[model samples]
Target: MKIAFLYDAVYPYEKGGAQKRIWELARRLADDHDVHLYGMHYWDGPAVIEREGVTLHGVCEPRELYVDGRRSIPQAIAFALRVLPPLLREDFDVVDCQEFPYFPCFSGKLHELVRGSTLVITWYEVWDDYWYEYLGRKGLFGKAVERATLRLADTIVPISEYIAADLRELGRTAGLEVVENGVDFERLQEIPAADADWDVIYVGRLSEHKNVDLLLEAIATATTQLDRDLSCGIIGDGPEREQLEADAADLGVEDQVEFLGFVEADADVIGNIKATSVFVLPSIREGFPNTILEANACGVPSIVVDHAENGSTAVVEDGVTGFITEVSSEAIADRIVDCLTDDDLLADLSAGAKAFGRDHDWNVIVDELEEVYSSVVQRER
Candidate 1:
């Protein structure tokens, strides 16, 4: 079978959950099927290259579809217009499109019509009410467009039950499957653990939506209340880096926080996760953070705030894998202090997290995905 994946960003190039998902799926599928990736040239590279049985085709130039961790919808629409000519010329058995930069999927749908290929929309999560939270007044238009896309999808693959619920709420009645994200266990195990220098670590973009300020406040409060040497590693860069740095100083915990900007996933990120006592991400929204899966693979438990829309909280089994805190610094701080101070509880959670990660290996995930792809193809037949 021939499979074509449509997504703008590729992992390690643009660095996000969606990027990682597309990269992982394309490579894994390549071993068994003819796989080709249709994405923007976010990094310096040839227009076409083959690696690990997967062929990558750069449909657009670097920074053409995105800017500063945000999607320019209008540019995305223009990009779709530019992509349509070449995209319609190709034929595949199955075409999987990422839900973001949503306009391009219309072209994929046209490909399905012209070639009789199955069209599958890989939905990480739906931005329902979050449009307002993330974009203030202009979010109304964003929400409308999002719903319109959902209604047009031929098949929707949601990553979590939380996302599945959002689709049902939007009146989507069929062609949906919930496939959880997985970790690269082999890669993580290859790297030796660094010295456990960090008491807590938070990886990912330091954006407003991530609520890194809340993380800083919690780290400060936990350190003050404990009266001991407690330090955190903030790994990743974003628009909020300067403000978060100032937040640490303003809260008088400048010495306790280290902002290590954008370490490569295969290198420093894995080592850091193995070395940390706890992983924390207080984001108000998420589809299922790949970072959490990576932390668990490294035997590091996490403390993530509970957001009903964000299915990431579902991965945390409260006292078992990690604690789920309310959306407040005080609640998060209390849990951090408890985990850092209690060796027995921390050890138990770490063991549990690793066990949980083992259950969702990429091999197992791809097996399920293959089944989905075959089923979709059969339905078309």
Candidate 2:
């Protein structure tokens, strides 16, 4: 099958969830099928390039769409519309619409333009009341657009059982299909031993939902109550950095926290997780976090808030591979203390975490995604 992956950014340029998902699927699927990746242009960048047999096309002023972290919705929409014609002319067995903002609606419109074809809209995210906590939730104007895009889609792909349930509650007709994010099996095994420097590690985008402030507060409280020199390593970067840093200072835990803004090297990421006594994600929202999977693969236990609405719900069995707590600093601190003081539990978690990751190996996870693509293509015919 000649598969076309539609998205806003991909490959060497982007490396977060959206980029990771599309790249993993395309690379894996390309083993047996032809794959093309389409990304909206932002700054008059490269017109075309091939990376590992996957063709990339960038159109639209995606770069100017945002200036100083603020965006112009009108320009973004107009740009996506402008890039549609050339994309629509392409031949594809199936078009996989990745993430939201622009990819799904834009690609869905293109799929509609092509007769006798299928558009499988993969919903890594959706808009809800809680989404007001983060930007990119479909606003009133975007809401109307989402309805049209959802209606036009041939299939709906939800990343987790929780998201599937949410879609059902909203009464969307396309039954939800579960396909999760993945972790590299061999590379995980290839990772050097975890470092022993930091007591706790947090790896992921430093966004609002991540609630790094809460983690800082918890670290401060834990340091005071535990009466131990517990240093934390925070990996990743985002808009919340300044506020989080300020909060750490205010909490008097500046010396206890280290913010390694966005560890680009895998060795750095794995090393931190390996070094830590436990991994932590105080995110208020999530969608199959790749960080947890990576940590679990490395035999690192975790302390996460159990809000399924954020995709953290099914990441693991609570109290097994990792412990899930309420979304609060106090709750997170208590869980961290438990993991720290309890040696037996930490050892058990260390083994259990690695064991849990085996089931979510990319080999198994991507096969499930392949099945979804196959089913969607078959049904469309």
Candidate 3:
């Protein structure tokens, strides 16, 4: 079968959960079927190139994904416009488009209408009420766009059940299939652990919704409660890095926290995770966090916050792979202390975490995606 994936950003070029998912699925599917990717050109060469047997077509020049700590509307519009012409020229069995930014999905719909291809929108998060939190009065426009995009796809593949529930609430009960995010478990096992070991680590963008500030506060409280030196490693860079660093200093945990800004290599990120005793994802909102699976693959149990918008809690088994606490610094600090203080409990969780990670390997995920694509194409026919 011929498959095409549509998204504004490409993996390795721009690191994110959705980008990684498309890259992994596309490359693996390319092993058996013809696969192509469409996105902004983050490279220096031609507009089209081949990597790992998958064809990548750069629809436009790369643009800054964000402005003033929020997603850039102009950039999204630019990609949405540029993508249609290239997409209209090709016809494939399946064209799976990412559902964020909400413009390119319309292009995919147009392509499906003109070219007679199956359109699959890989839906991530459903903002709904959170739109007001993000855009104030202008959220009405965002909400309208989201609702319209929900109807564009022949099939909608949600990354988690939380998102599926959101779609149902918005009256999109039909054609919704849940396919969760995955990790490269085999690749993680090959990378050696980093030399320095951290008592706790957090890997992801330092964005506002990530609640990383809460992580620092939790670390400070945990340090005092433990009555010993606790080292924390933060990997990744974003708008909130400076403020988070300042927060750490103000809390007097600067010495205990090391801000390792954006390690480009996956091996390095996984290596650091492997060296950590515990992983913490304090984010209040998440469609699906690939980092949680990566951390579990490295035998590091994760601590996630229990929030309505945080769909990542589904992937973590509460007492087995990790612990889920309320969205508070004190609750997070308590979980951190629980994992750090008890060696036997930590060891047990580590074993369970690895087992959990093995179950969500990228190979298994791609297999499920292949079935979804085939079913969609057959239904369209």
Error of 3 at 171 (Å): 1.4
Local error of candidate 3 at residue 109 (angstroms): 0.3
Off by over 4 Å in 3: none
Q: What digit string (tens of lDDT, one per residue) describes model 2 on residues 200-288?
A: 98988777778888899899878877998689989887778888888888988888899989877777788778788889988867777
Q: Which stretches of candidate 1 lie over 4 Å from their true place?
A: 42-46, 64-69
Query: TM-score of each candidate?
Result: 0.96, 0.91, 0.99
What would the per-residue lDDT of candidate 1 be over residues 1-381, giving only the tens digit for each residue?
A: 899988777766777888887788779999889998877766566877887898888877755444665767777776667667767777899988888878878878888888778889888778878789767999998898788778665689988877888888889979888788898777777898766589999999887878999989998788778988578999999888999999989998888899999887566788888888999989877888899998998889989998776677877889989989999999999999999889999999999999988887888888888899998888888
What are the per-residue Cα lDDT tens digits for candidate 3 across 1-381?
A: 988899999999899999999999999999999999999999888999999999999999999999988989899989989999988898788989999988888888888889999999999898998888899999999999999999998689999888899899999999988888999898899999999879999999999999999999999999989999799999999999999999999999999999999999988998899899999999988888899999888899999999988987887889999999999999999999999989999999999999989999999999999999989888878
What local lDDT does model 3 show for residue 67? 91
Worst lDDT 10-window in candidate 2: 129-138
Q: Best to worst by lDDT, what's the order?
A: 3, 1, 2
The lDDT per prediction is 0.84, 0.75, 0.92
lDDT of 3: 0.92
Which predicted model would earn the best TM-score? 3
RMSD of each: 1.6, 2.7, 0.9
